[model samples]
Target: MASPQKTSRKAAGTRAAIRRARPASGRAHSGDAGDDIGLDALVGHAGYAVRRFQLWIFQDFIKTLATVDIRPTQYAVKNVIGANPGLSQMAVAKRLGIERARLVHLLDSLEERDFVSRIPSTIDRRSHALHLTTRGKAALAQFKRLAAEHERHVAEKIGKANREQLLRILACFT
Candidate 1:
């Protein structure tokens, strides 16, 4: 095996090479270093663009609903449950791409807040049916209103026509 001092020196040399490669503009790069690593290659990739857009949407959504004290996933889960009352937990997990255990934790928090209830399933005794309580319905209504405002912000950022086109394009993936 290489000596510890040799490994340390090699690592330091690698870091120095990275520093030398960085742009001289002094602006922070995307991943690391205090320089821009021109994103020409990433700019053309659809997945990269989509990920960047998703990040922006999430940040804006979180900021918009900061007062509501809800996260993007929580909002999505509650919305799905609100719309599909009496849905099975596993069904919800599948629909929302959330793991069963993670969904249970989210449901626990919502139940504690009186925003959701897990009732005994009529069809499957092993599974629980999810539903929103009266308070949850009211809260969901408010959430929808704020979410609309967030959508409006999105529309403003990207014009209505572009947003519609983007949605049409993204629908293929969903």
Candidate 2:
């Protein structure tokens, strides 16, 4: 009987022969065997593919926002302030999943742009309430329209049904 090593080598040789007998390609196919993992296996952990797709979507969004001179995070901040007037900075930070310090910086930029104002809360001097200035509101309205257009474009690319399912899945993750 053949040694186990010999048998394994023979089997591998037979497989290689069979592969070589098939059509030859112009592409060079030299690589370590471990490098040939399937896409699903490579990006399937914890929905890595989904995360990658989200990144692509965000890239498109950032490009769109660039035209309007607004960043995606900035739009998010403005929208939250628009929806929740008198919202506390801490509350905004908590709801938006932004760190308190980062939120402060974001608020500072908005304030500098005259897009938002921080007024002292009537109930607490330490906590400031947030409000959108008229300019801010107008800017938000424009952002909303642009966002709607971009959303529709993305939805068309991903299909309406898949878009709904994606939103549901993302909500569950968050």
Candidate 3:
């Protein structure tokens, strides 16, 4: 019979071998699976399949947003103003998570297009209140419709349930 010490060593070696033989569920190892690394390095080291899939999804969103002639940031600003009529410039900036100075430039562009107006605030004489013009409201409506269509398309690509779950996960991140 084998010595007890040798038998224990043999059992440990067999377990290690079994673990090594199993395929990993996460990122496949090209080499050095035990290497300690940061998230960026790990994502970078991952196979191209996952990265390509992510890029394709982003590309679709970019194309959809482009169709309305509004970038994602512009859409966000318009949505904030639409939702909060008579909101102060500072308030809108805060709600949209943009700097006051940057919001000014965005408001300027919208104002030039007659999509929005900044009037003296009734409550605060020192501040200007934001409002969407009829034109602005119409534009927002159009953009919203387009967004709905885009969302449907994406949902079709990835099931509606999955899209809802994705939104929930993203909300947690924000």
All candidates' lDDT scores?
0.87, 0.82, 0.77
- Whose TM-score is higher: candidate 2's or candidate 3's? 2
Give candidate 2 regions above 4 Å deviation.
1-40
Off by over 4 Å in 3: 1-40, 44-59
Stretches off by above 4 angstroms in model 1 are 1-35
Worst 10 residues of 1 by lDDT: 34-43
- Residues 1-174, candidate 1: write the lDDT tens digits: 999999999999976665555555534566775335645445447899789889999999999999989888999999999989999989999998999999999999999999999999988899899999999999999999999999999999999999999999988765
Per-residue CA lDDT of candidate 3, range 70-104, in tens?
Answer: 75667778888888888898988887788999989
Candidate 1's TM-score reads 0.78
Give model 3's TM-score versus the native structure.
0.64
Local error of candidate 2 at residue 143 (angstroms): 0.2
Ranking by lDDT: 1, 2, 3
Each prediction's RMSD over C-alphas, in Å, is 12.8, 10.6, 10.4
TM-score (all chains, Cα) for each model: 0.78, 0.74, 0.64
Worst 10 residues of 3 by lDDT: 35-44
lDDT score for residue 77 of model 2: 89
